[model samples]
Target chain A: MAKILIVDDDEDFVSAVNLLLKSNGFDVAIANSRQEGMEIFDKDNPDLVLLDVMMDEPDDGFVMAQSLKKKAKNIPILMLTNVGQVTGMDFDKDSEMVPVDDFEQKPIMPNILLEKINQLLGK
Target chain B: MQIIDRQKVNEQIRDLKKKYGDDRSALMPILQDLQEIYEYLPDVVMQETAHSLGIHPVEVEGVASFYSFLRTKEKQGKYVIRLCRTISCDLAGKSNVARQLENEMGIKFGETTKDGKFTLEYTNCLGMCDRGPALMINDRLFAKVDPEKASQIIADCRRDFLKSDFPKVVPSDVKKAGPILDHDLKPAEAIKKALSMSRSEIINTIRESGLKGRGGAGFPTAVKWQLAGAAKGKNKYVVCNADEGEPGTFKDRMLLYEHTDFLLDGMTIGAYAIGASKGFIYLRGEYLYMKKYLEEALENRRSEHLLGKNILGKDGFNFDIRIRMGAGAYVCGEETALIESLEGYRGEPRNRPPFPVDTGFQGNPTIVNNVETFIDSALIIVKGSEWFNIHGTEKSKGMKIFSISGDCERPGIYEFPFGIKVSELLKEVGGEDTKAVQIGGASGHCISQKDFNRTIAFEDIGSGGSIIVFGPDTDMLQVARNFLEFFVEESCGQCTPCRDGNPKLLGGIEMLENGRCSFTYLNELKKLCETIQNASKCGLGQSSPNAFLSIVDNFKPEILGRVPEAD
Candidate 1:
């Protein structure tokens, strides 16, 4: 089973995702901020990362994603964002400035997200 | 601790301390060097820096987080594409440029590409307003870039990345016109003239010319010199504030480039007038290309007896200047923050009870004048106050250098007398089919067609010479939002009003843009901006809302496109 790191400030969302991933037989770890996320990422060396666009600040998640990509170039990342709703600017996943394999907007569909995770992890 | 070589890091830190001096003030430069070495400020490096500076780790961390340039992350890409998203560039269709880059590189504004080849990010301004839409790939600037050019630029970067050969892309040719003072004049001519006059006479000439600091704030140059000269201190210093970080303003760059010796001569003259032996030119980091030229000028001056050890061969008038580069902070352009950055601290603005004239650069009496101000002083001394005063209005005397860009046939530098109307300038710069004009970069006023009759004087509509004309199709609300986002990222976060208030204003602007804000909410935001203007610690915070307020005041109908619901 491939291990995945979920780095987000949304506790309820993280718990829900954690339960879903675990039920699907994937190893899961969680971090609430960029610093904490990096620490866990270093420790676990997760095969994939689920990053949020806004954490402590609006661009914190993006900054964190860049750092993570630097550390592990091949580790695929799926970005979580409500940027379109917040700023009325839609972020295209394929044309994102930050390096992210996919984007899952908030109020995520469990099946779609699982499919994306599987696609990114090459499972 | 484990990531870096301990001995090597210690040696580099030691070298930095020795070079910048052993004082705690060297902290900013030291941190900048460490960041250059490590790509970002790691926790271990911060701790070591604190230990080296003999300060607490929190202080180091606090300073590191305060500056926009200093990053604490480890994820910088090979080519960081800093696209200028300020008003001038925005009006010049920077959005299209951004979209093209995003589509080509497969990344959004803040994301690095998958191959670590590119990291697209938005920058406040690269001082190339006359060449917008401008973007910098690393420190190499690419100006006048359209959507097609942006794609080619990115492709060029990818090619360079693959080949490991990164050469600076030559900036597109910017046409120069109008009455630029002393463009072809020799270096030490003004200084020689000033050397013949009494110190008081030089100050009086500047006063008679009615010259003011051209760094946005129209404080009288003569009065500033008088204060510094009269201040009770033996170790007086003259600091030429070459840190021209104002968005859309690059007249200083032109001045420094074309007339390097003229600016240095002016600084030397300032040192003599103020009875100061030491002088420093705080150059901005973005214009690193100008550094070598300036250093070469300084070297020539030293050899010619125009700078060091009794400049111009006069005893008791010894003076010299040294260049100190800024490590990319917009707030450092503020006088107090510049002083703080000079002293090696985070470029945070200090409270103004003891102004820089009284307590500056090592707590000595110092005179901090802008690059244009120094050049104006030199010209005033040589040309006589009466001759210099003949050009401008009653209050705002002397010619001003304007960096005109966007929505024009010919965009570049133009020098005009202060009382010249906006329409007149528009004609000169080919500003046709104009809807609005943003004067003085992000933190200056936005004027509409009705205000074209307004004169460019301190008494009417003053500026630091950044005029960005927008055609009819340009969106005023989007322009305002672009400036607000600039303030959001560049705010030093020292005070509550600025730190918290700017982001709120940005959010409010977004809400309004999306038609989610009510009239009452807009009014509240206006009130909040007033508070921020009055209560913020420094000029950055105080003037941050100028464009927003001006846009709202002028284009209320546009901003209120949606009708307000009754409570």
Candidate 2:
């Protein structure tokens, strides 16, 4: 089973994502912040990372992702965000400027998110 | 925290100490050097820095946290894309540009890509107002960017990240009535004339010209010099504040570039008048490309004996200038913050009553003049006070350089005498479809179409010369939000009113933007703004609420629409 680390500030979102991932038979870990996420990443060496774009600060997710990448360059990162509704801008997953392997807007359907995770994990 | 190389950190600290000496002010530069070595300021390094400097860890951390450029943690991507979010850029479709980038990148503002290749963030201003929709990938700037162009630029960067070619900016095509000071005068000619006059004569000439500091404060230049000169201090200093971090303002860049000699000569003359042997030019980091040219100018002057010991071959008249680069802080443009940064501390605004002229830069009497102010001094000395006094209004004498950008056919620098009506300036700049104009970056006033008759003078809507035109299609609420956000990010967090109050204002604006604000909440926000304007310690916090107040005052219907309809 692949080890996935979910780093998000929203407890409800994290719990829902955690339940879905566990039912799919993946070992999961959770962190509430960029600092906590990095600590878990260093200890567990997760195969994939699920990150939120905004937490304590608007750019906290990006800052977290950058630090994670510095430690493990090849680990796939899937970013979660509700920024589209807020800023009224669509996110293009194929954008070279975004270092994420995949992007799922907030309030993601469990099935759709699972499909994205599976595809990114090449399972 | 990562275990940094102890020997290496110590050696670097030693080198920094050697370069800046044991003065407490060197704290900012030392921290900057450490930041460069370590991607982020590590805890171990901070402790080590504190130990080496003989200062407490809290001071180091406080200074580090105060500056936006200084990071305590490692969180930078390979390519950091900073999009300009100032009023002028916003008016010129910066949001569209940001939307394009976000859609292209699969990430919103302030996110690093999964591959660690890119980071998208919002920056205060890149000083490229005329060419709006600007963004910077590291130090290189891309202006006039649309969605398509943003995509193309990203593609090019991905293809060859090292040498991605972008459009080069040409100097402003300024329309002038006649040979102004900058255009007509030869380099060092004014300084030569000042050197011939006694120090009192130089000060009197500047006084008679009715010259004022052009750095937005509009303080009388002659009075500032006279105060510094009279102040009881042996090692008096002259500082030229070239940290033009104000959004939509790039006139200083032009002055530093084309007329380098005049700027240096102005500083030299100021140093001579103030009885100061040492001078410093606090250059902004964004304009690091201009450093080579500035250095060359200084080198030429030194060889010609225009600077350094025994200036102009005269005994007992000695002055030398050194360039100090700012590592990215907008508040450093404030004279006290600039001084604080000069002393190697975080760029925090010092409380007044002992102004910079009396107590500045190593607690010495220092006269901090704007880049233009010094250049103007050189001109007044050469051209005579009577000639200089002919232009401008009764209070604000001589011509001012206006950095006009956004919603104009010709968006560039323009030189005009004070008292020019807003409507006249709009017409001259080709702002045909203009709805509003934001003068003096974020801190300055917002002028509506009805107020276009107001003149540009110290008595009227005075400015440091940043005029950003907004078209009818632009949302004034969004413009106000952008300015509020800028203050929230740039505030040094020294006081509660500024650090906390700005974010509250931003939150209120965001609430309105999202159609969640109530009439009661809006009234509360107005009171909060008043408190911030009246209670904040520095000019930044005081002037921060101006845009929000003006937008609400002028465009009440637009903001009211943000409130949900009465049930």
Candidate 3:
């Protein structure tokens, strides 16, 4: 089973994701804050990460993402956004949506998300 | 995530002052940094800021909490998600957008998800109105959002945590591809148009267009004109409500900045429409830049004979416009309070029946309207009401301007026809992830993804088009607390619920944060929220509890947490 760490302020979503991933034969750990997320990232050796863009703090996820990048440069960062681009910021390079390994919107679809996870994991 | 100490905050302030000079302008960035470090600026932070900079603590505190960037109170959750709910996004179903994030996250507006990982929030105007339903996940903005996109974004963020290391997503270099509106009509031309337009014709034309007020209440522009015009008085006045205190709504600023002449034209049309001789732009003192531009525009018009005893060589529609500054009071936005301020009284709303239209501005018939309402007059005259009607819904005709700010990619002012879907606007603007869209400023509703199909028309948009979008990462609880803090400060201290209840609401949110409040307390507080909305005298009081109410209704579980700890 692939070891995964989940950092998000939305515990319900985290629980659901944990269940979904665990059922799909993956080990999951959850952190509710930017500080905890980063700490866990350093402590636990997870194969992948699921990060929520906005946490209890507005930029918690971004801060964590930056920290993760600083700690390990090659780890894939899948950014989850609930309200997608309210500011109309286009991150796509050459017409393709900017891919930070992978991206997903909120209210996750279990199967679809699992497929993306598998694809990104290359399992 | 950084535990910023006061020393670090002071040092940052000193550095900012050094870089930007000791001028007051340097404080904004310093306060913003403080908010970033502390999540919200505490009272002590303000005092420290003042002590460090050799300024009065009150001044520092005033400036710190005045702008949306400064947060003086603690929020409910560890993570904060501020979603913009303005008109642009409302027409785009920002409520549904917000709701989708709630459902997906298993949270609600102004509530933390059960695990305390996030807090949802609502922001008034993010200044990116053009891209309806904007959101800001931290300092980064993503424009043009929809429900599905919001879910996808959240999922992607979750995936990042699953990885052992933090997500490594570098923001791309931004490219300014769209046309930036940099041109303004010449004062000479604006004056000429203002002079030529006849009073009766302007009224008739506007009446034909079905234009309504852009402010909270959508009153008919033409009927208001006729009443004001018919009122028996020599001391008639035209007052423009430029004191836009509502959060997430800055179309007025855009108009004052980019289309001052149009406002003048509209006011002139209104002046002619209602036979008012003089007009005052009741401008918010916080909008120093907008006031400066408006003053300059007025000066230009006066120099070119567009304001005083004017003649476009044919018709003599003589009128003048003056700018009045508001002393940073939310109550002044109310017509009665605005009038009281002009009369040198404490800014407070008075009893109605002898509405401003009947006995206003020194006991004369007065016409007060929002800046956007006035701007519509010029457009209605230029293009017939039929043309305006073709764009918007039958009841509310014409395109509305929205300041789209928040997590969206493009944060700017957008003009779109009413009834547009929230999802469609997001897709058009390339919003790949949208959590929720807050419509009608902080007082507006929080929409989820399921309601994306809702149209962005007048009846549905709620008030005017101040649309804010949130990315999937937003925490509703923190956002709600932020708005509650605003209410506590912005309240005029008139009614009990609004004045006294504000602190209580803030306290309730705090209790929620401490993990001490009982579920019964929350339920009671929710009831109080409704009572405040129903009994409060003014609009501000009435809508003060909306942020909390929306959260309680939409995201109850998020607010009450899974733990049953009580104080």
Candidate 4:
């Protein structure tokens, strides 16, 4: 089972994600802030990172994703953004995407999230 | 005060080299100190700069003269007032504002006051279009100002300068004083000089003066002239890249208006420099006034025997300039695309190697330069290399003109020494509440508070002068996305990456707008943006992603979203 690190500000969400991954028979680590996420990433050396769009800081997720990629070039970064008009998602294209591996909208359905992660990791 | 000779200036440069380590690194700052001491960079100053920098003086000259912000010639003024006349400011009524300043100061746009208190000029957008009606007194900015307010500001500056015991001889306005072509010369005189000059002499004069192409690439003007001349074409042509496609840059338009003859003269001179008999100006279709001005000026020049064959009773050098208006296509600004547009094809960039200097325009040699670059040639010929060499540092030989716009107390075009500190520029032009300044125009980079220390020089900033300021409330992400939207709409749909990639990136912004995008989708958008920047074939495709990168890097939260905890 590949170990995954999920970085977000919400503790409850991290726990829920951990439980969901554990039931799927995968090793999972959680970080609640960018600093903690970086530490966890260094310690666990996870195969992938599921990053939240907004944390304690705005765009903290993008910054964390950049940091993660800088640390490990091959490790895929799957970003998590909130869904709805309030966040404005209509402007993105496949070409304009950052150097990140993949992205998923919030209100994450388990099947879609799993599919995206699997596809990114080429599992 | 003595006009410092070349050897003495070189010694000062040498001392500065010991004080500051890398001469190339110290290029702008050294020029700044030199300009402070000498008011403008003379040819000797350039020689000194090269000696101090341990590089070819031509390199220093190239960098200095390419930018519009640096001033090299002498001016009889205590103050230089630059007004923003770019499209955005035009929409915001800059003409009236400029006229007001002219009337109140009792000096035309390039003329110093009889009392030697002020010189006035108008320039393109300085990037603060959102605030509109911008003006610069040296490096200081005043934005959202009306005619009356501008009058008050100028009056106050003059009064303050006059009263001060420690008056800096060049007026507090020297920092804002760019090349003032405020002189009114007959259109025929301007055309006659350009028509009479020999190709090699023209090239050599420009070479000695160290002028660089102003159309984004910063190529040496003299080298391009030489190449185009030697291209062995039976029918060679010269082109003025007046398709001013950059979003926030409007210096060319100002050049078209204030010095109409100056530009035509430069083109004629360029034609002579490159051994070309025919010339075309591919002006952006949007500049209705510029088209009218050039057409009338061309007519006037023709009437005076300056444009026709063997005019000056010599070996019959025949040349004429015509205007070809563009139909709202941004890509036409690119050299190859411009050639394509002129040839009645879709404006798309052609691969290089057989550059336009050789195989261009109907399979003949062609040379293209921005309007400002060509205008400087007239001054270069009139003044000589020694005159052009004085204003900027060793690397950048002459003055650069910048269009200042955006949220500031006052904003407009500013001409100054090449190496003036960003902080000093902000202090000079940006009002007290200034937050950030965008260098290079809308498509240019957004310099945040952190990068304020970076000097505004050719080596650091990529292209010609355009400084746009922003205040506390400015939405950087929105501003950047707006820039992207411009690209999306303007893309000619010639290439897949530019056509498809532009819309896709724009779609990401849409997702952000709807607020429906998950953080994951936004991340995907970021990934795609990188591909566009790295993979695109043309400048539009490459730079289209710049605003997105700046937004993603600098204003992340605005584009990304927050997620609630799973309850």
Q: DockQ of all candidates, in order?
A: 0.01, 0.01, 0.01, 0.01
In candidate 2, residue B278 scores what lDDT? 93
Candidate 2 chain B: worst-modelled 10 consecutive residues by lDDT: B161-170
Task: Name the candidate, 1 or 3, with the larger TM-score value.
Answer: 1
Give the CAPRI class of candidate 2.
incorrect
- Per-residue alpha-carbon lDDT of model 1 for B25-122, expressed as tens digits? 77887887788777678888888888888899898898887765677765567787888887777777788998998999888988878777788888
Residue B383 deviation, candidate 2, in Å? 0.3
**Per-residue lDDT tens digits of candidate 2, residues B427-524?**
99899779999888889888888899999999999999899888888788878888888888889888898899889989998889899998888888
Error of 2 at A105 (Å): 71
Which model, 1 or 2, shows the larger lDDT?
Answer: 2
CA displacement after TM-score superposition, residue B80 of candidate 3 (Å): 27
Q: Which residue ranges in model 2 land beyond 4 Å of their true spot?
A: A1-123, B1-3, B100-108, B113-116, B159-161, B164-170, B173-182, B564-567
Q: What are the Cα lDDT values of the candidates?
A: 0.80, 0.81, 0.67, 0.67
Residue range B1-567, candidate 3, lDDT tens digits = 435577876787788667644654345546655665666777767787778767788877655544443456553344455676644455456888899889877887766676655667676544445555666554345556689867765665566432211132212212221111222334345335544555545665676777878886777787677556644566779999988877776667666765677778778767766667788988874453355557788888777666777434445556788776664566778898888766544566776656687577766789999988877776666656786777678777777766566667776567766667888866655555887777777777777677667777667756575667777767777777767877886787768888898899889888877777788888889889888998788788888887788766666667778326654
Query: What DockQ number belongs to candidate 2?
Result: 0.01
TM-score for each of the candidates:
0.77, 0.78, 0.56, 0.56
Better of 2 and 3 by lDDT: 2
Q: Show where candidate 1 strays beyond 4 Å.
A: A1-123, B113-117, B159-184, B565-567
lDDT of 3 at B278: 85
Off by over 4 Å in 4: A1-123, B1-175, B180-198, B513-526, B556-567
lDDT-based ranking, best first?
2, 1, 3, 4
